[model samples]
Target: MIPEEEGVYVFNREARSWVKISEDGPWVPKEDGTYLAYFRNHICPGCKAFDRVWEELIEKCVDKLHAVPALVQCRNFFFDCSDRTASDTFLLFLVNATPQVIVMVVEGGELRYVERCYGFEIESVEDLLAFANEARERMRKYAEEGEAESEEESGEELVVEGGNWKEVVEKLRKLLLEGRNVREVCDERGCRFVVE
Candidate 1:
């Protein structure tokens, strides 16, 4: 349900760990060290291109992403999916609204996670996290498995139309599945979700 007012919500890996992320005063880094951070006040978080299948979904959906490890917590030009940076680190998604999505990743920043306001029949924290984690896991499998499949198919007659590796990457960025993740990705997309 789209609310008339904006809000903030935080989802944690821990059970029942969804809390309303607060921004009372200026945001102070949790640790006093080098960190790659993406911050902004107001920005839309949705994709464009209504006609395209998943293009609209990829429009305004990235909040926090790091291109590299920093010596200090550096500001990321305060953007809301306006610029897509080539990062070898992590991705941060910023959703603009009350009860907006706030992310604080401490480890495995490279292993990304995606979040958004309630997508399905969600009523609790676990429900929300379940959706987010499922999407991420499935997406990862789609990419990794698809790559493996492509390797085998590379010797075939029809090689994805002149070997468009980039097109394959684009499919992943769009969250489409090229092959089944029944093997690699360890069926994380199939089962083992926080919520069903």
Candidate 2:
């Protein structure tokens, strides 16, 4: 008996607020800080079993972290109870099972997926809180690393050699897009490339 039109209601403990979100409405962005999302399905037996545990976990960790509870419904199975936003969110995270918990945070103005736990991961409320804490620490570390990299980049200079500057730049661009480390790229190419 879930209302699809209502979308999803989640209590954000960090903001100490309630957020009603939809794919067509206000969605949580990375700039908003850290949040946990719980994906579930109404007809799922695992979800039913995890419901009680989730409630207890919320009660125990309400003051420690923020969480968003979302119910994902299959269009064919629960047509009337299907929520587009919830379903989309589930797909966005590549969730293939019910009772999935994901910790998300904002780093450099972009959403970062921190950690995820399935139904079997939660034996108690403390376990869930611990997972949240781990995710927070990870986000903090990533933010710090990003800041350090930017600071270093600001002070460095790019020295492109030879005549084909465009080709060199293109190769550098491809390396960056491939997620290779900048320092490693520079060391391997023996070129001092500065990212502006």
Candidate 3:
């Protein structure tokens, strides 16, 4: 499936509504970073460039990353800026912002990494793929670290190893090189699972 290409939409918790605020390629995010409520009303138009870029990304990444299946994604940030609340959706697009990809792991609404460079670069498609793979790696590390912290609070040994995720990373490498559907690959490889 293709990702969103245009303006702000609102995701209302109460009514489960997606109200679209704009229809053009360029859309502005509100002060609170919300577009979901607007999109539900269905008024926003699609962006051609964003559509093209993300379509290419999905085609290139779907077979390598199981992430698509697991996350309800939207390109909240389009013009190098987005509000904090806009990131309620799984993905945020820092379009034309930097020459790199930034992966953030938020658990309980808290940032996990301090220093960037989890392979986030804009040099090439290879760079994006590396960023994606490394992003996942870092997220896994964050989760395990969180688990470790929880365990430490309760007094337990850390049993999970980062080595376990290496297999998925290898598959990701194949998908990046061969241009595979990583969303499907993840399910088949059991890296990450989501019904939709």
Measured by TM-score, the strongest candidate is 2
The per-prediction CA RMSD against the true structure, in angstroms, equals 16.7, 14.5, 17.4
lDDT of 1 by residue, 13-125 (tens): 23323233333322223432222222222221211111121112122221222211111011121121222331111122322222222223233323233233311123334
The TM-score ranking, best first, is 2, 3, 1
Tens-place lDDT digits, model 2, residues 2-45 = 33432555665566444666645224453646666666655456
TM-score of structure candidate 1: 0.24
Clashing pairs in 2: none
lDDT, candidate 3, 3-94, per-residue tens: 24333443333343434443222232323211111111011123222233334454555455322211122332221114222322212222
Per-model clash counts, in order, read 22, 0, 33
Global lDDT of model 3: 0.32
C-alpha lDDT values of all predictions: 0.27, 0.54, 0.32
Total clashes, candidate 1?
A: 22
Which candidate should be chosen as best, given lDDT against the real structure? 2
TM-score, one value per model: 0.24, 0.57, 0.30
